[model samples]
Target: MTTISALPLLDGTSIPALGLGVYKVDDTTARNSVTTALEAGYRLVDTASFYRNERGVGRALKDSGVLRDDVYVTTKLWNDAHGRGKTRRAFKDSVKRLNTAPDLYLIHWPCPARGLYAETWRALVELRDDGRVRSIGVSNFQRHHLETIIEDSGEVPVLNQIELHPYLQQRELRAFHAEHRIVTQAWSPLGRGAVLADETIVAIAAAHRVSPAQVILRWHLDLGVAVIPKSVTPDRIRANLDVNGFALTPDDHDRIAALDRGARVGSHPDEVK
Candidate 1:
């Protein structure tokens, strides 16, 4: 089992640097995958109400025998659930489904078109204040969305989870996050298998005698970002966490940096709504 480290968030809390993501995983698969991850020493599990697997994830945690305080679980409110009343109610529903208060709650997306994200952010702050959640963050938020919410609510998100990978580096947005002390977390750290086939990443993996996925994950760690790579296969789930052996050189980073082509396998924030 690999022991992952933690990074401190701005809110005086810490999160496991690496975690399991159950984006498209079915409820039954989520239960098994989360159980596998926990047994492999993963202390963080990222899910969302949108994923529709909170019940399975919650059951895994309860059955895994891992103490509640030892795991850092995260869940998000979907786009349609954005608003003061809806956000609070959505959170309550998630807590009930999760069978525990989530350590971190996030605004799943900015959904700028709806014009309710700012109000939704305030509701998240309220949840944190009410002690319903330990930390609050956002996902897929562009710079303008972040600024708008911060300006409106006077509360900056503790983290921003985004579609980031070797192909879509989002350097500018990451810099902005650094300015605000918000941790940058990559949702699809592998570029949805796009980067796995790139010659640059493949060569690096060969050099380290590790799989392509490990090289990409190692690169993500080197970039000072959190990553949640999802997989239902037990072997891949275990392999994803076995990235602590080798280190990436400056040359490797530069090579991967050059591979950035502004490519995104996921939807843009502006187009989501």
Candidate 2:
């Protein structure tokens, strides 16, 4: 089994560097994928209330026999649940479905149009104070959105999950995160398969004798960014966790860095609402 690495959060908790994501998958697929991933040595699982598979993820965690403390489970509050009261209630509902408080709870989107994210951030701070969650963070938030919440609540998110890959490296926002001691995590880390066919990535994979996906994932790991690659296929699921053997070279980083085009596979933060 691969010895999965981890990244430490400002809140004093650490999350596995690479994990599995359940985005469009159904409950059955989520359960099976979580089971396979746990057995294959993955210690992190990222899901969201929007995914509607928290029950399945919880089932796998309960039956996998991997002690809950050893597994880092992260879930999120959906856009519709962006208010102090609604955020609190939405978190409880998610925990009820999962049968345990999540180690990390994230706001799924900024939904700036709704103008409730700052209020939601205050509620997350309250939840943290109440011991309802281990830590709180945000997803798909741009620098301005992060600033709004941080400035209003006087609490910085422990991590910011975004659509990041070689095609969209997010260097500017990442620098802001570094300034605030916030961890940057990648969603759609593979660029949703668009980055897999790049000649540069393919060449790196050929040189390393691994899949193009592995090369891309290894690149994110080398950059100290947390990544969650999603797949329902068992072979692919296990293969995604097998990137511990090799490291990316400096020349490889330069080649891959040249691939950035500011392309995005997911919705932009400002357009989500």
Candidate 3:
């Protein structure tokens, strides 16, 4: 089994750097996948209320026999729940479905069009203060959105989850995160499988005798970004966590970095709101 290391938070909390993502995975598959991941030594599981599988993830955690404090669970509040009042209620509902308190809670999207994320962020801060969640963060937030929240809430988020891969290097945003002491978390570290067939990544994988997926994951790890790659298959779940053994060389890292095309597969934070 793989023994993944943990990354420290700004608050001195430790989170497993590699986690199992449960996006688009249904209840049955989520249960099996999360259970398999836990058994394979993964202590972190990422899910969202939008994914509609929190109940299954909850079930798997309970059945896996792992102590709640032993695993790091993360979930997000949806766009519609971006108000102070609604944000509070949303977290309660999510916790009910999760059957456990999440180690980290995030605002799923900035949803600036609705003009309520600042209020939502305030609510998250309240949640953290009230002991409902250990940490609070934002997802899909660009640097500007992050600035808005920081300005309004007067508290920096612990993480900013975004779409990051070899093709879409978010250098400027990452720099801002680092400057502010916020950790950058990669939502689609594999480029949604697009980079798996790339000649550069494939060549690297061949040289390392690893799969293309493992190669991409290793790149994220070397970059110091937390990654949550989702897979319903048991083999893929195990494979995703088996990324700690290999180290990418500096030359290999530069080769992958040059593959950046600035392409993003997900919706822009500004467009979504």
Candidate 4:
């Protein structure tokens, strides 16, 4: 079993540095995957309203025999619910579906053109205040979006989930996050598995005798970036969390750094709206 460590968030709560992401997966698969992951020692499970599988995750968590408080659950508010009323209602629906309050709740996207993320941010703050969510954060937000929310609400998010991988390292945004004491969580941390077969990553994996996915995830861990790599395969789900054994070398970091081509496998934040 991997000894997953925790990263302290801005709100004085801690998050698991590596976790399972249930994006694009259906309910049955998400349920099975979450159950298997928990049985395999994974403590964090990431889901979202857009994923439409929160019920499955909730079911698995309840059935997994793991204490609810022992696992860190994160769910997101969808783009359509970017206002106080809808956001609150969406959160309530999510809680009912999950059968419990989430440990961390995030705004799925900034939707800047909608000009209502600030309202959604206030809703999240109120959720935190109401004890519906332990910590609140945002996903797919740029620095400007982050600043806007903080300026209006006087509250900074605990973390920011972004599309990050060796091929699309958001160095500037990462620096901004570091400066602001915001933990950077990587969605699509493997570049949607595009980086799994890269020559450099493969070479490192060969040296370490681990899967290329594990190598990339280990790289994220080394960089202090929290990762939620999505997979429905039981074996791959187990392999993704089996990354606490090895350490990447300086040369490995340089090789992976050289692979940064500013590529993205997900939508650009500014263009999402």
- Tens-digit lDDT track of model 1 for 164-235: 999999999999999999999999999889889999999989998999999999888887899999999999
Clashing pairs in 1: none
What is residue 185's positional error in candidate 1, in angstroms?
0.4
Tell me the lDDT of model 3 at 172: 95
The 10-residue segment with the lowest total lDDT in model 4: 264-273
Candidate 1, RMSD to the unseen true structure: 0.7
lDDT of 2: 0.94
Task: Say which candidate scores most in lDDT.
Answer: 2
User: Which digits, one per residue and each the tens of the lDDT, describe model 2 over residues 114-166?
Assistant: 99999999999999999889899999999999999889978999999999999
Error of 1 at 122 (Å): 0.3
Query: What's the CA error at residue 14 for candidate 4, in Å?
Result: 0.3
Clashes of each: 0, 0, 0, 0
Which residues of candidate 2, in runs, are more than 4 Å off? Answer: none
- Per residue, candidate 4 scores C-alpha lDDT tens digits across 161-195 of 99999999999999999999999999999999799
Score every model by TM-score. 0.99, 0.99, 0.98, 0.98
Error of 1 at 133 (Å): 0.7
Q: List the global CA lDDT of all models.
A: 0.93, 0.94, 0.92, 0.93
Q: RMSD per prediction, one decimal? A: 0.7, 0.7, 0.8, 0.8
Pick the winner on lDDT between candidates 1 and 2: 2
Backbone clashes in candidate 4 total: 0
